[model samples]
Target: MSSYYGLPVLKEPVWKVPDVPAYLYLGGMAGASSTMALLADLTGRRHLARAGRVAAAVGATASVGALVHDLGRPARFLHMLRVFKPTSPLSVGSWILAPFSGLAGAAAASELTGLLPVPGKAAGVLAGFLAPAMTTYTAVLLADTAVPGWHEAYRELPFVFAGSAVASAGAVGLVAAPAQARPARRMAVAGSALELAASRRMEARLGLAAEAYRTGRAGAVLRVARATTAVGAGLALAAGRSRAAGVAAGACLTLGAVATRYGVFEAGRETARDPRYVVEPQRERVGAPGSEVRGEVHRSSSDGDLQ
Candidate 1:
């Protein structure tokens, strides 16, 4: 083994890079607005729908800033749209995010006399059209990653994230109106269930890639995150079972869900930065059942301390 300052050098790359902050901001905005808008419109709460629209707009705009900031050079941001690159997942999402943000904004704005000259039915129709896809695209953005944990758990990662996004925004809705607490609970419950189902599968199905969920600072955070989201989300189902439980569930569950997202983000970055995360296990996957994993369970240089 080679050594970089007495630390054994592994064969692959460790992606300790933080997630694109823009994606973080935009993902929440897009998710919350989409769910709240759909629910509000269905419940005949035009006001909530409008609020959802505004949040989405603000969220989208903020996201663009985050995206631009993530780049080394902000001026060249337009280059993202200059080409139609299916090979690029971010490219696909940018296109989708741009238009969906517009529709959600317009739809939400229609209820405001100041934003629209004539508040009419077309806005509702357009918003309805954009809502579903808006809910789904964030998952695709994440799954598109080449990172082992992310790309390998492709089938369920999107839904797991989509559920988390809705839960966060729905928490906002719960805080906004007493009337919404019931439905908000439902959203949390469903999203939590889906998130856990996907997550468990991610951990169980991907032997090595999913190692991000089980070890290190990021992994430790992820375990707590899962517990929080699970307990919180499960309590949501019983919100009708008790008011105090409902309030506690809503607040805790929402926090837990958000924590899960952040934890995964942290873990992925850790996995990327460590060559052991990238190589050793992958090699093991190809060898026979009992083959030794080439590089995993990092034995840090300073008596096993990781960064």
Candidate 2:
């Protein structure tokens, strides 16, 4: 087979992966719902809070659905919870997702029938509980993989993923429930800021691997991510007055964040295929005994056998 730019072609998994991306979207939607739910309830907007709870539940359910469908054996999805391993991000994610799903489900049901006491209050508490994990654990999920860019950028990726999740959740709220757009706008700003800051920090620490962000197709993606995040965050400053602007910024941030994830993923794969990253680090690590200077060695994300 002819090579694409002479790069070694690694076969991606053969199983027909569903639109795995929807999982990411659902995650963001659930996370945003939690924030909005709590804010609305706290501010005496019971109707708004009810709406957020329903949305959170629906979004969380959808996220889980997408994740399951993406697996080669969708039925085995339940096995995610059968055991526990801290080193495995998926196992941890399953735990994080479990409470959220139960809570969101309860909250959503309460909204539909108002059949129970303290529907608004219970939902608010659940939303508050799900908010942080919804934002953060996604990073862990991807980071725990043997994937290239993901495993390497462990520290900042969680924050980046969290930031993206928060931003997207706000975007969904803007689309599905506009009345709570103010809190949504505020969250978009915070999430974008955190996302940008974390990405920048990763770019700084990853060094040559950081080139993944600054080069070729991946570079273009990173640029868009940075630009949208910056613009969206700036737009949020005065968004309280203009719902339309908030909506637009939220959408941009959401799309941009997704793009960043894909770009980083592809870039990491590219890094992995090359011999340079694989060879150099080991060379430094395999330095001669008793040399004048120490040459500490480390593995590159590519073929460092660490994946």
Candidate 3:
């Protein structure tokens, strides 16, 4: 019934600390590394498998540490596991993180100690099965919120997140297990392609809501991310003859993935900061011609005493 121009209709996200994005980056690395470990095990690439398992364990553990630090207290992290709510991403994520961490830790420990081979291999398999959910659920968590950029891009965010995950894991593999860099290179290229395509589609479809991602600091960061991703993917696919080339490609991919996460988070903040993003859409939806007329009449009658 009231004009909302230049007025914020919703609160921005409270997750302003650096830890949140760090957590997201580390979690993606863990999930993708877990998947790589599973594939390497199946293919009997022992070196690569060991690298993936170690990466998964370290990344997952670091992610949890970030989450706990972000919460301002360790107990809040513990509190998240008090219940298992299927509908809540954070709840489901907590459960997913718990088991995945254990499995990853087990796989890494066994690899290091050269003991308990059978159970460790089983844990790796199970962790791989849960890897997709671990990597992509954070997208759902962000999308479920009221932030315009995040909510509007829900369709493609999962693909974006997954692609970033793959690129990250591939970068780690390239550095940690150079002997088996072929698969990592392939994954990086594929992931970069998917991320670029999905991001383009998301921008094309978002209309006015997409402005947050196209202007200011967020825009610059995203542009750099895209450019780096393309360059990294090209180098990775072509780095067959030189070790230096492989390292450069892997470094670029890792940087691009990190930039993507930060850019996405900043874009969401930009959307929340701009009132037009919130007000104009609601105005279009609720202040159509007929609705505007009815609203005016109601307001006029309510002010009859003044008249």
| Every model's TM-score | 0.76, 0.79, 0.91
In order of lDDT, best first, we have: 3, 2, 1
As a TM-score, model 2 comes out at 0.79
Per-residue lDDT over 179-287 for candidate 3, one digit per residue giving the tens place of the 0 to 100 score: 8888888888888898899899989998788888888888999999999999999988888846788888889998898888888999998888777787787767676
The C-alpha lDDT values of all candidates are 0.64, 0.70, 0.87
Report the number of the highest-TM-score candidate: 3
Candidate 3 regions with alpha-carbon error over 4 angstroms? 1-7, 287-307
Instruction: Locate the minimum summed-lDDT window of 10 residues in model 2.
Output: 292-301
The lDDT, on a scale of 0 to 1, for candidate 3 is: 0.87
> Quick one: RMSD of model 2?
6.2
On lDDT, the leading prediction is 3
Query: Between candidates 1 and 2, which one is better according to TM-score?
Result: 2
Badly placed stretches (over 4 Å) of model 1 are 1-22, 25-29, 72-74, 112-128, 238-250, 285-307
